[model samples]
Each structure stands twice: as C-alpha cells, then as structure tokens.
Target: MLNTWYYSDAPRTVRPMLSVMRRQSGFAEIIGDIDQENATFEARRCLSCGNCFECDNCYGVCPDNAIRKLGPGNRFEFKYDYCKGCGLCPSECPCGAIMMIPEEI
Candidate 1:
C-alpha cells in the first residue's frame, strides 16, 4: 500500500476540444455574437492545478453517494461509513481535491 487511493481500473471519459472562435453574425458582419454563458463555461475549463473549485465532478460521479454537499462555497465531505473506499470519488475528482489515504490498523 502506498498510503494513497489509486484507482487504476477507473474509466476516464475524454471530451473533445471545443474551438470557440469569434464568429461574425453574418457573412460580411463585423460584430460577433457574445455568448457570455458559453464563454464562462469555457473559461472554467482551464486547468485548476489541483485545487477545489466546487465543480461537483466528485459529488456527481460517486456511485455510493458517499460524498455529501456542504452547500455553496463549503465544498464536500465523505461519508466514510457509506464510502466503501471504492476510489470513485478520487478518480473522478477533476481538481485532485480528494486524496485517498490508506486506512491504518
């Protein structure tokens, strides 16, 4: 045991890269459609460098539903009794917020 939760068998879903370019409204139009919502989502796609941004990736992917939401800005917590140590939460964690520590005897 490396004292960590490593899910080597977890399946990873690869999403296609979206190219968001400034597209003109018309063939000859110079103005573009400012999609602020889409832009914001795309902006969040940037690498978080292993920080919790409360994106809910871990919370959403937990099969056991062991991860509990602590409301907005509070992040989440693991219900160890229900967690079963499946490593699903750690694997699905996009920002590496969940670290798997080995259970000591």
Candidate 2:
C-alpha cells in the first residue's frame, strides 16, 4: 500500500485561494491553485466539502491530461484512455469529487 499521512488537532486545510488581482477579475482561472506538496499535506486536513466549483486544479495538475474541460459550469470528464491513475486528480481536487481506488494488479 502507498504510504499516507494523518493529522490530529492540527491546522486546518487551507482552502484554495485566488489572488486579490484575480478575485477582482471576477472569473479568474485557478489552474495551479494547489501544489503537490501542499495537497499531500492537506490530505488529512481536507474538509470533504463535496462540491466541485470547477477550480480547474485537476485540469492543471493532471500529468496525463486525462481530465477534459467541458466548458464553463459543465464540470469535467475523465478520459480513461489517458488516465494512468497517478492519484493527482483526487489529491488536487479541492472538493472531494474525485477519489482514488486501488486497482488490483
């Protein structure tokens, strides 16, 4: 099994933030909202809010480019043809929409 970390009574998972300039831009693109290291640390801290606001974190962090942007408010789709189950989507997903399930070899 891949190693995982757990936190208790620790700091909360910092929500993906938009820069002040971006915020003022009204609809800013938050592609690289969360970093890999930051995402890993926030695993246990995740709020599991269960809402995909379509921040595009998965789109940017996907190394395989498996995620497809269906346009504004359309959400996204996974192209299994490209997905290698690298676990980046789930880790980068701000909302708990995407999750990783172990595939038996």
TM, every model: 0.55, 0.51
- Poorest lDDT segment (10 consecutive residues) of candidate 1: 1-10
Residue by residue across 40-98, what tens digits does model 2's lDDT show? 87775655476676778889999988999999989999998889988888876766777
Q: For residues 1-105, could you state the per-residue lDDT of candidate 1 as single tens digits? A: 121233233333333333334233334334444366656655645555566778787788888989899999888888889988888777777657678999999
- Model 2 residue 30 CA deviation in Å: 41
Runs off by more than 4 Å, candidate 1:
1-46
